[model samples]
Target: MKFCLKHGRCNCVEFYQGDLAAQADAPYILEADYKTWLDVIAGKLQPIPAMVLGKIKVKKGSFSVLAQYVTASLAMIKAAQKVGIQ
Candidate 1:
């Protein structure tokens, strides 16, 4: 999955297979405003709900396909929370 945080411009983060990178080709691309991403990473909001609520938009993939990896997705958020924004 690739996440593009839209803060005027888009800053992208990609999770492909088991690797994470600033940019990469991915089958799934999720996009949202910067604050929405911050909320997601902070655990203030959950990804699925955010998507259902339309706070997060899937720009390049299917939500049903992405939903199958809920555990991995949440794990990614947890991992991000651990590292935090420097």
Candidate 2:
């Protein structure tokens, strides 16, 4: 999971996918609620590890939830490649 999140993150993907409509970076986040994001972060969801618990706080909108995941995925991928998680 970690590997898929942050592999070669520098150019593999946009670290900041700023949204044009929102005019803010890290846009393209997710479409989930705060609790949903929390659940994913708190090990209440599958395909995710318990380590992500509470590392980040949920926001008022979907962007907040999605951004964390996007950024996390990038990091995970990087870490995976870093440590040869494969």
- Model 1, 9-79: lDDT tens digits are 33766455322322466566677788998999999999999999999988767999988878877877887
Candidate 1 clashing pairs, residues 3+ apart or interchain: none
Residue 28 in candidate 1, Cα distance off native in Å: 0.5
Error of 2 at 63 (Å): 15
Each model's lDDT = 0.76, 0.39
User: Number of the top candidate by lDDT?
Assistant: 1
lDDT tens digits, residue span 1-86, model 2: 00112354443333222233243334233334445544544445532332235434232245335545655654544443455422
Error of 1 at 46 (Å): 0.1
